[model samples]
Target: MAAVTLICRPAGVLPKLSGTCSPVLLAAGPVTVQHRKIHHAVVPKGKGGRSSSSGVAATVFGGTGFLGRYVVNRLGRMGSQVVIPHRCDQYDLMYLRPMGDLGQIIFTEWDARDKESIKRAISHSNVVINLVGREWETSVAKAIVNAIKDPDANGKTYALVGPNRYLLHDLVEYIYALSHRPYLAYPLPRPLYHLIARFFEMNPFEPWTTRDKVDRFHTTDMKYPDLPGLEDLGIIPSSIEQKAIETLRRHRRYRYLDAEIGETKPAKTVSY
Candidate 1:
């Protein structure tokens, strides 16, 4: 399950720390705002929208990932201040600034493997949403931000799964087909995959088939039961089919040449 950390603070002026320490300003580039104080009460000020204050200072741990970007967008539009921790090029994350009002999005560089760096990234946040996964969708982000604002969701867990599921092998083939590539691959035995993973660990350029990932392919299920989901947060989940073509089109063999209307067969989807 994806873990979301919420540290509740009372409304009004925050008490100063025991010893005198210089206040750390959370700003990116030239964008600046008054020093932020921790608050949980949704004392919304201004006439709403981006310029207003939602009283939420969120540190999105995986802000550069697929789902995190959308979550940041929604949070920005709703007037919430977001702290984005990134290790990638600072330029890559600049596009996210316009999503919120000026100074609403703050970027801090942090290494994920280091505990101290992670602590610094989330130091000023009242909420921390961890969407640290490769496979994600827009609906998941919407649901997450919605949950963050809902007082009832303070300690609840919400499962964010897509509307449909497909076998890994079938999904890979469909993606290749979208890219106009011939599919001629077979899954190797589990033991062989483990051996290959060990070899690739030492290789400079690691491929997608890592041992941990291979283990996940067999262990994780897309559709899980007995948990709250996106619908509970008033969100209708989007299907992967809705975005696959748009997402994979760039990888098409020829950039200008479009595929015939029905060239690729649709992968079988399991509706949950």
Candidate 2:
């Protein structure tokens, strides 16, 4: 009879494997595999606290004004505690009082024109939003420009309208200047939207498509002094502002202003 040879295979270990394996083998009872999962608690660098989700803090300036009020409302709705510094008292803040109840409004007294006040405001806030524009008939342009440039220089000194036409030219210039800053400015995220709302009223024409009508109505309602009755005149629908805000939300882009202090590097060069 020919001699018979037997090849023995290992019982536990597999011979050769290349691709991924499911149900990895292990010794039977009470096997403890050590796994290290590094969980890094990223703390925001500055005084502005980290967001639980994005880990960033949001700060809003002029949080009591018309646009600011809307911004603060949106921020609060997003569960962000917005810091609003104003020189006026509670009675003066009547418009903003509703926001206070939202539990996201923090009110403090600080003059935007004063550097000390601004510095203080910026200290606790991660983002700095400048919504203090001149609505009165004075040197609003110069005031806003100085505030943007100096970050200090208190007292409302800019003239609203004059040979300067500050609202048109200076406003655009200041916005441009702010765009150059390292940190994102308040209105920069959605500047065109704010500009159109702040500057003009909406008017829609008939025979327009529903999308066009919605767009016209949305743009028009962003301005203050709501005109629901105007819908009858074919200007804008009553829900224009709400619709625009919803549109902005759907895009994950916010038009409100917030600040990140110290994160802003000084401008190397500024041009008029």
Candidate 3:
């Protein structure tokens, strides 16, 4: 006889669920039992509280920002309740509701400077994952996943990083191709870049490049960190060439109806 392994989604294969529901379970009959929360413990229908899923309850700060939607979606799909702290209007978050089952994605309004509110947000969580660092989205997510799953990761910290190295010029050219936009990445003096960043800082939502980022780029030699990275956590970091399109799809400047935004007609083939 051959053994079979079944995995239902993108988070990799999960262990077989145990019998006799405990994680919010409602029991009616042997075959009629179902769980309340999604993944943590088995909860039978009727015996358990009415909830969509469980396993981890994640409180994601900056959960409504860029990279946030992706993280929230991933968490929601994995049978976790993502507590999103938002200061934005409720309508802005409406699109994220469908990412998970009912009651699986919670929202709380938070002020960054409020210590008590920060404590309240994390009061029920067992894990703390910070995506606060600028441009820290894709890389950190992989590390957080491993740390959660690997017991060896307990008390250890990892710098979630991509494998590809890119200069500012390199990234700009990639984005130009990926977004199919005519933007140019011009190199500016370090001091001028800092000045521009400081000016833009006045507008909380305005886009600006920070001095820390510029400094880090230099410190990192315009690449991922020297420490063990995503590979250490069993995730192969994506190349900029690979990750650029999907990452910039929504920002594509031109779009023709009835077709995908990022993909234009294939480049013309010329045989010599």
Candidate 4:
């Protein structure tokens, strides 16, 4: 049996951190959320996180996404009652079923812009895990969870992040490395990249980010977050260099590349 865990959400002064990290400064109102700190434990695979007894009913917004899955999995293993509210179809949410005990996991159809729908879903639940902060989009889902579980960090916004900045080209290189395929970034002019993106954007089947995204990416600093991060919460963010290779291997398109993780081989069309 897993130990009972407590998660807290607080309302208080936000701490100062490095770099001018900006979000519409939210004035934290009186927060009533209270729970015990969840210490390290296993994330349930098929053996745990199951039960008929009701536990902490936690509502996870954006539960269908990558980070949401991580938080939900942990909560399931811990025997918390997880209520995942999603706008996606049933097929997408079905995978989360095994995370909790038989009746402990729940789902509600809801829309974010509709406050009532949002409120209704979490009304019966006490703890709420907000994973909607995607401005720093490519990172921080799991960090939101660690923040909610921290006590001293009670009520403060936890700005979790990767150790360094990564560009689109850099990520492509890492994916190729996972498959042991040699690859190179053929730098295209800024305007040219935007043109290609726009073409893809026009195709409904191949959506792409707007040019503004490219601008935000270019201006972003590779430095770490100045505020309380993974370290402050006792979590050492995994090494990006190493994790990238492993993570990419799971991708369907690159799964065929049979190189062991971190090992790379020459591309079929390579020059000695």
Provide TM-scores for the models. Answer: 0.71, 0.31, 0.61, 0.63
Q: What is the lDDT of residue 75 in candidate 3?
A: 69
| Model 4 pairs whose backbones collide | 6-36, 10-155, 18-226, 50-101, 51-101
lDDT of every predicted structure (CA atoms): 0.66, 0.34, 0.52, 0.54
lDDT (Cα, tens digit) per residue for candidate 3, span 108-215: 888879978876765554443444443454555545544554544433335554554445555556566666678655677878878887776677674566667666
Model 1: per-residue Cα lDDT over 66-152, one tens digit each? 878998899889888888988788789978999899888989888878978877776666566666664566666777776765655
Q: Clash pairs of candidate 1?
A: none
Rank by lDDT (best first): 1, 4, 3, 2
Q: What lDDT does candidate 4 reach at residue 126?
A: 44
Among these predicted structures, which one has the highest lDDT?
A: 1
Query: How do the residues 122-185 of candidate 4 rate in per-residue lDDT, one tens digit apiece?
Result: 6655466655423433335445444544546544554455555555565566666665556766
Cα displacement (Å) at residue 46, model 2: 22
Query: In model 3, which regions exceed 4 Å deviation?
Result: 1-52, 137-139, 177-185, 202-227, 242-272
Q: Candidate 3 at 217: error in angstroms?
A: 7.1
Q: Which ten residues in a row have the lowest lDDT in candidate 3?
A: 1-10
On the 0 to 100 scale, the lDDT of residue 99 in model 4 is 86
Off-target runs (Cα >4 Å) in candidate 1 are 1-43, 175-181, 204-209, 219-222, 241-266, 269-272
* Clash count for each candidate, listed in order shown: 0, 18, 12, 5
